[model samples]
Target: MAPTLRLLAAELARRCDQDGPHADGTGTGGVAEMERAALLPPGKLLRPLLFTESAAATGMRRADTLAAALGVERLHVGSLVHDDVIDGDTQRRGRPSVVARYGLPNAIVTGDALLIGAFREVAAHTPASVPDARRLAVVQTLAEAGVDLCRGQAMEDELRAQGDRDVDRYLRMISLKTGALFRASCLGGAQLAGAPAAAQHALTRYAEHLGRAFQMADDLLPHTSDTATSGKSALSDLRNARPTFPVLLCWHRTNEQGRAQLSALLAGTLPAETAMETLRVLLRESGALTQARAAARAEAAQAKAALDELPATEARAALHAVADLAVDRDR
Candidate 1:
């Protein structure tokens, strides 16, 4: 991470530790605080990094920009907390997940607390130079992103239940689930910098494509990386029977025998470990892994192209690097 981003991440972590309501009724020093703190620990901080970098690209690095960045990070962390619960994941970043440590109900409340803290952080700390109307716009952006995020999560659940294989539908769902916040992060920074509408639109597109690339790469991690490398169980997605990009692509490209094997695995007819091993083989043999990687690389290229519309600067160069990072990250 760059020095500025590292500083911003540290500040955001401090804020998360200090601002939220305690999980325990005592309001301090309890399991709730511990859970909240655990969730906010240093990680990629990708959303906030995007926000700060976007703001910098617009030649704006005001206090409000940092505040917006922090807000986005909080929202991202909250989503992860809830995602672990929904996926029944017991591990995150190589540690026991909040759901695993505190149980589901507490984890739910912990996520909600972080979300509420995100709004409060935005409302209280947006730069003083920003006018009231612009600040309100930033708040509205966060609110809409949150709504779309929930809708996407629900859509994912429905798709999983129905075992939908339409790649386009999956793309749209991920755009909502993952891309919405990325869009919001970029928009918040641009808005904070008071960039014109054209620039904001460009950054939004950059974020959208970059987000898709990030998620697609992430979807491949279970097949390509181990638990130690990826920081979560490799079988988590398979265990939940989630129809990830690789799985769907493999299904579409493979022979009937391969499809039947995948179906049996997803239907829980095969042992979990054996099923995952078979699915991995099927994906590799069908060229689905290669295709999925190509898709991610294509999205990253689109993201970089979008940066061309922005004013040329070192920040823009950094954003270009971010696009590469999205697809190339190992974890």
Candidate 2:
């Protein structure tokens, strides 16, 4: 890892692990443990890093944003807990999901606790050095992003139930589901720093494009990697019948007869094992994989371009590298 990234990771490990509320008056501690399980061994720490980096790019002190960064990460983890419950995914980052290890009720409570804790992290934990107005803006930004996330999740479920396969709508949904939080992390960092409007917009744009690329890359994970490598069930997307980008791409690129079979497969008319195998074959042969990769790259390129609006700082340069990583990473 880069020196800056390594330091940030260490900081996050220390700060995030100790921040959860223990026992909530009942002294049960189970909810806190579930929250710990969901958070410890943090994956990527992408949002917090982005938060700190975006703040740094504004010539602000990175250390001052630590509480807010922690808040954003908690919000992210909370959302992931909900995602696991919604998808019935038993695993995450090679560990049992919060819902899997703890029952659904505890998982829900854990998620809610994290959500409540996240707001407190922002409201009560921010340094006195941060201005009141800017702090309010940051809070509003995170709240709005959280709303977008919920909307996006609902949109995804609607797509699955209605079998709506519009690629444009899919992009919008992912932008809301994924990009909104990225925006909050980056935008909130800028807000905490009292950054000028222009810098905030540029950083937010960069984050949104990076987020789109990241999600596109994520959609490719099951198609390209095994459960061990991807750290999740390979058939998760197909099992949910979630209309992911590559799946839609494959649908659009294939012949009419292939489309018919794909529909039948999605509808469970065909044997699941056979459908999974056939869909993988079609994704490979139909050029959809390559096309999907290209789209992710394009979004990454846009993310990099957005950095051009910022001053030539090392922090901005790091953001540029992260954009490439978003698309090029395997997991």
Candidate 1, residues 1-331, lDDT tens digits: the string is 4866777867866765664454455666554475456555667878888888888889886344787788787788888899998889998898888889888888888888778777876788886777877777878999999999999999898898998989999999999999999999998888878889999999999999998999999999988888898898988888888879999999999999998998888888888899999998999999999999999999999999999989888778888988998888779
lDDT (C-alpha, whole model) for all candidates: 0.85, 0.87
TM-score of each model, in listed order: 0.95, 0.95
lDDT of 2 by residue, 80-166 (tens): 999999989999988899999998999899999887777888888888988889889988999999999999999999999999879
TM-score of 1: 0.95
Runs with alpha carbons beyond 4 Å of true place in candidate 1: 16-26, 62-64
The number of the candidate with the highest lDDT is: 2
